[model samples]
Target: MDHKAAKRRKLTDKSLPNVILQNPDFAEDSQMYQSLLEMERKLDWTITRKRMEIQDTLSRNPSTTRTLRIFVSHTVSGQSWQAGTESDNLTHSETGENIPAWQLKIEGRLLELPQRGKDKGPPRKFSTFIKRMMVEFDRDTNVYPENNIVEWPRATGHHNPPLDGFTVRRTGDVPTHIRIVMYLDHYPEQYRLNPDLSSVLGIKEESLLGVVQALWNYIKIQGLQDKADRRLVRSDERLRAIFGVETIPFQKLPEYVKRLLSPPDPILLHYSFDPSLPVVEPERPTAWDVEIKMEDAALKNRMGVMLHTNKETSVALAKMDEEIALLAQSLHNSHLKRTFLQSFADDPAKFIQTWLESQSRDLESVLGAGASEGLTLRQEELRRSEFFRLPWVEEAVSVQEGLRLASKGM
Candidate 1:
């Protein structure tokens, strides 16, 4: 019999503590149980490792796993612009079908080769490396209701820099990018990066094309260039076309947003001490102010409805009451997206044209003027349909009154 069985036979009438004291063999049995538990735990660890490997295989990975996309347009005074106002005004362009992103089709064939007992099959065919899907960025740098354009001090300094997005990725037989899940990029500190080991890790590696664009965006709003003498890069491109530690080249845009071609420090995340510290604290307005806000909302709602149904007006005032109600509902929720539809009620042609789905000849007209003068292309997006013109409302109201007069004439 085992140690536990022998000890149990001798402990018939003894209390638990007394049993352990008199029968020292019982203590040995306890140790044996602990040893057995350790072995089981080790077994579990082995099983876990194998399960993870199986799961890794179960998830069919694509050859090209990841892709970086950029949305770029022109902005003159980026930082001075209000974030809340910009969020409201930001819009997407329309295409023939008017979808947010237009998908591209690639001629790729399925690779199903090596039949049961036969030779290998043909390789997958691909016309292009990766498919391009267009995302629109429609800012109201165009004709609209006269809201003052917030301008910052011009880059009157030495350098006028432009930004560029430079992407470094592995080439494949098929032109598709594969995203690494565990992420091997040497630059994980900046979470968006996919560390490529083909080069050095945690060092100056390939510049993330997406990051270059985002960096440009951040720089446009929060530039590092001294506000004065910043135009030197633009004044004489031959002499000084670069800025900062990385020879980020200057272009003809709002920012001297330079692209770091080489690898640098591992982009680590900014670990904050107090996220709760209010950067822009909320102010509690008085009771009278609340009443004014409500009245404004009501008036804006009425105006919006009238504007939305009237294509004759330049503004968007569709179903103003309903639109306001929707806006109110959206406001009731606390979660914030990067942009909101409420602000674009003035004009959205800027966004619509960029994401163009309509097969209209006017698209060229809209786009051509945009490149030069920031014309109809970047008009603020109206949250409502085109029927919201002022003339439409006047006509509708007049038509109803005219019908009543006709009945009186009868």
Candidate 2:
């Protein structure tokens, strides 16, 4: 009875906390948890910093849209014949002596719409809003649109400079009507596809994004993707002719497709200028309507509201994240304590003996003491055929083989 009482006292003296505190693996795991928590905090701070930077940039450059109007006018100005010695013999009866010169004027303006409930009047027009305008003529003309056309910000005028108008002297051999091409800022440019591309896409003109999407669809339908590598495309006969290659990389499709695209054909407009009529008629200037992509003010306002972060909400979120991290750490510590106590409660003496043996083995390994002897003993035990014949060994091998086969199948 005395011996049994001494054994019980010895087991009771070895507490669960002492055993856990001495474990090297548990200490290493705790340090790793601390490092992970620190990394998470740094990651959260980086995300918040980036978000704030984006918000600041968005606030500085708020997007807005404006309406642009293109105006064109045609008028005829008569030039009287000067008293010259060369044409003195020519009879005044002939109409060739006095010829009328026709002039075509092209100008543009930006219109500002009134506020919803504040102003009730016609849209205000401004000439300074036009950043750049390019006008191209169908045939050769005397006057050309100026290069790098820019309007004065403070200039007050009915028309923008450099693109006011053009005058033509000879009209006998020239075509009756002409085609004018205009490109405006803040507008989506359209492209016309070549015959081969058009045949494949079934579209003559479309936006660049639309063309790319259509090409992607065609590739999907034709199954032109390479079997071995998805990034490469096996071009069909039609695509081969268009791209000039049997196989093409998917990324280079856009560069090759751009070669097959051209600007859309110019629109034709006819004008009849009468010298007898007044220069400024009631319906003198002809206007052509064009569609422009504008920034949505309502959508922008919504985005602004979303981007406007509340200081209180941000503080609350940060506090919540910190609290959650603390709770997670507390939970992890509680779990470790619970596992230690449960093992001790199952069999106190056995748990204490096993824990002390494990710690001694770890200490010996760390100090490089008696490691060769332990390694030799383990090798001798493993070398015996009886070790492989154990029931648990077969079960472990079966489980490992099953996991490997499952991974390969996946």
Candidate 3:
């Protein structure tokens, strides 16, 4: 198959759990496919019906009604561009280094009711405006590609492109900005209740629901409707603090609720180089590291699924051995990080010395084994050996020992 065809197939393939992938028998299980198909059909029908109902409502009353909603999505592009690859894609022209890019999409809609004239208290004409924007970003080395944004149905299409007035802008060097956007886009628990709001209502701030959803839930729970009219909300102590009045027209509640939200604090991106400023190292692994960890996890899961499939099979047993070895190495690295790295955080010099010593010890063992067999270590062997005595190692060791002694005396 051609590269493009293969890539398309890989992209379109249904992502099965590690178990199903490891066990092809399960992948082709007719019963499983049928069940999934049936569930998908039912969900589609239910969603289609609900959407139609919403459209009907909007069409019936466009003048005074509107839906205030925002949706975010992310997509990963495997394509990369080298510097000076202007013909291929927009990229840096200097170093010719490959630049990685991904896309983020944000969509929002607003419905406005305008006052026509003195005779008309409020405009009867409704204006519904929908906008969507897609932004491309250089994915941070620590960002996971699996966090790719999936398409959702909007209007008559799935995975719709950016709408009118959409534009792309580059951000500061920090990749966390992109990471944050992706996180906010796909966060599963979106609607956690705010503490201040919860206190006013005398309820615990529960699930991670958005402010709008949380407020709606609070209103429903309180049952604080106007005595004479159900269309109005009668203010209690909490509602009074919220609405600043004893009553709020049901239609205006949304407006008031929105007012309570404080805008998020701005993130600092640009900074002038200052030699006086202390250098701060990254606190955690980058997206690239995270992607590798995820791959390792998937491999482990697949291995387990294979083992469970048919433990007697020679192929499965051999795969299990290989997976076990890989897992062991991963565990060793994790252990070292948790052990020495955390302990020497405050003393980086000591950390470096200790790490070098550890490497030296391992190398010594390898060299000793080679010598025991009457084999002379070559230049390549010496270079690769951690314990191969070097001038820099001696100097670092001396400095580390002196520092340790000085600290003890002090």
Candidate 4:
């Protein structure tokens, strides 16, 4: 009895927390209970390690794991440009598609593949690399009338896919349970503005333009360009409330905006894995594997499309070349004929022929005797005129005068 009691004490001592071993019925199966507890603890640890690995994979490949939010920027008729205006007359020449005067601001990070000998994955600094990209109005929102058909941008007919969707929670601060969760988005502060700044800017109480583009637009519309230099912006009484000074350089605008408008409470998203929920790997393939397969299929389709387009383009080009060749040949023949005809254009034979045709009737009507008399009178008149100007005629006249003087002397 003493030995058995000692064994029981040893077993109870080895059991953890003393809570399980204290039970009257548990004493019989204490070892089994201890083994089960050990297994449960080990399973929890393994699950936690798996969760960490999954999160790391997600941050590295957000496209496959995370669904990015597509921010929609609307331009209502009154708020933005009206239809049929100069600004609304934009069109893309390449696609022959009209450009939407109002556009959506789809903000996303460009995940550039790391260069050789560098970190070989997406960038970690989300805010610095976040870019506001413009997209079609119809893509992210359905605010436009159903009848209005928005054309897709150029080179997007084949490759453009819909944006992924994910659970979003907008909160004031980054919540706890950071081990399992990862932030896929970082939103700008969104809070109410100072009453003085709002009143001076002439914007509604609800409007939030405190930070960047929107505030800049207001400054531009107010014609606040400094007289001395355009780069220096001299503010009016309204803007003075925000800037705290009469003037500020355009570059320093963001600094003043930060000062004037209170930044909004942070918007946090909870992406943590639920410990209570079972860790069920989907029966469907992993996102990476699925993406790889889709990419390969897409590449093949694109190549086929390109080949077909090139063939059609080649045929069209050949037809155009044939037409051009025909036109050139006809032009060359015409030029040769024109040269041949122009060579004899100034020939003496042609001139004589033309003159004879014009004077044929008048030639037969002339009087012969009158014509001969006219010809003789014309010859005599020509000889008389030649006598005064000719050197030989002057010499002969001088010789005759000398002879007359000699006769008088004799």
Q: Which segments of model 3 are wrong by more than 4 Å?
A: 1-195, 198-210, 266-410
lDDT values, one for every candidate: 0.31, 0.57, 0.44, 0.42
In each prediction, how many residue pairs overlap at the backbone (N, C-alpha, C within less than 3 A)?
A: 70, 0, 15, 1
User: How do the candidates rank by lDDT, highest first?
Assistant: 2, 3, 4, 1
Q: What TM-score should be assigned to candidate 3?
A: 0.23
lDDT of 1 by residue, 1-410 (tens): 32222333234222222333454554465576448446745765665565565445334221222222222111111122222464544543442121122111112222222332322433212211211212111223343223212211223234622113212211111112112111122212122232332121233333343345544444455454445556422222321323323233334322332232433332111111111122254322111100000012223344345324446432342344345445434533421221234222222443344434342335545655544344344344332436446575566456556766777899
Cα deviation at 310, candidate 2, in Å, is 4.9
Q: What are the candidates' C-alpha RMSDs?
A: 46.8, 19.6, 35.1, 44.5
TM per prediction: 0.16, 0.41, 0.23, 0.27
lDDT, candidate 3, at 162: 36
Estimate, for each residue in 1-410, the C-alpha lDDT of model 3 and write its tens digit: 32322332343342222433464554465466548546746765665565565556444332222233333343333233222455656545475323444334444433322542232233221111321112323344354454323222224344554352222322222333432221221112222234566576444422223455656667778888767898888877866765679888887765775555442322111111222222355222121100000012223344445324354565664565455446545644554565465556446566776775576566667766643342344546645867636676677677667777889999
lDDT of 4 by residue, 148-257 (tens): 22222223233643342222221111111321112222222244456676665554322233335666777788888877798888888777765679888888877776
Superior candidate under TM-score, 1 versus 3: 3
User: If candidate 1 were superposed on the true structure by all CA atoms, what would the RMSD be?
Assistant: 46.8
Looking at model 1, which ten-residue stretch has the lowest summed lDDT? 286-295
